[model samples]
Target: MTKRSKAFNIKKGDTVKVIAGKDKGAEGKVISVLIDDQRVIVEGVNRVKKHEKVVNQGGGNTGGIVTTEAPIHVSNVMLVDGEGVTRVGFRREEATKTRADGSTYTVQRSVRVSRKTGKDI
Candidate 1:
């Protein structure tokens, strides 16, 4: 059996929909990607509470629960566009020759879009 490399098609800023966890079906922007771990942290998904202690100069530290987002497995999410359609692959545009002006310009590239907006960021 061939070992599959841990790689995520999702990128930073890519809008993703959580397919699992407590935030299932929730959509948010990708805040960061942990390629090595095959995990990505969405803007508002997989929230985990962290207990923190406040150290005082005079006495001991006070502990409390701090709510924050946690890293989710990339496989549990899907990339979505403004039309709410999921994306499968990365879209890249190559420079092509134009006849009229003969100048190089970027064309409309098909990339993943945010489900909230049809515009690619």
Candidate 2:
């Protein structure tokens, strides 16, 4: 059986700072996540240019040099908090929730916390 990997704390739309690589110290919002490859694409980070040939499509033939952000390994980036870049930690908390039957139940939820500040992110 294949094992499923745990989800990363850094989600889409999260602000992250690149810690290592050519774009080190660059900060930008996360564009997408590649869980299988353990990589992420950050806005304005790891940009690369691609040359393309013009092709005729249903619309029109419009192709040229396209520059876009490339995927960066997740380990090279750190989540950014109000203080600065911080490591992520998980915290379990009990919370009460209402069910469809109007019954209250206590459930445990895992929340992502900042290691540096010791607060929920």
Candidate 3:
């Protein structure tokens, strides 16, 4: 048995603030979301050093101690809404879609919303 990836409200480029972790209170844009791992990689957060072996191929990439951002658990960060941080909420709204044949249909689409301001995220 393995864990499955679920839909997460957080997305790449969303600004998030670390709530509980070594980087508490630190804020940065979300670089990527790892749904399966239930983790997120925030820009400028969770920095780690990785050592690599030099590969030899015509102009092979240089390998050494490299600093990179590591993934932090999603529970450790909160989305930043304007001046404050808030929880992510979902709102279903009817949206119109057009088919290739020019036929239009209405569908309910879930939109990421801010729990604090009741605004779309």
Give the whole-model CA lDDT for all candidates, comma-separated.
0.77, 0.93, 0.93
lDDT of 3 by residue, 1-121 (tens): 9976788878999999999979999999998888889999999999999998898989887999999999999989999999999999888899999999999999999899899999898
lDDT (0-100) at residue 77 of candidate 3? 93
Give the C-alpha lDDT of model 3. 0.93
Q: lDDT of candidate 1 vs native?
A: 0.77
Candidate 3 residue spans exceeding 4 A from truth: none
Runs of candidate 2 exceeding 4 Å displacement: 1-3
Q: List the residue pairs that clash in candidate 3.
A: none
Q: Which candidate is the best by lDDT?
A: 2
Count clashes in each candidate, considering only residues at least 3 apart in sequence or on different chains: 0, 0, 0
The TM-score obtained by model 1 is 0.63
In model 1, the Cα lDDT at residue 20 comes to 82
Identify the runs in model 1 with alpha carbons over 4 angstroms from their true place: 1-5, 55-63, 91-93, 96-121
Single out the weakest 10-residue window by summed lDDT for candidate 3.
2-11
- Taking the tens digit of each residue's C-alpha lDDT, what string does model 2 give over 1-119? 76687689899999999999999999999999999888999999999999878889886658899999999999999999995899999999999999999999999999999999998
Q: TM-score for each prediction?
A: 0.63, 0.89, 0.92
- Candidate 2, clashing residue pairs? none
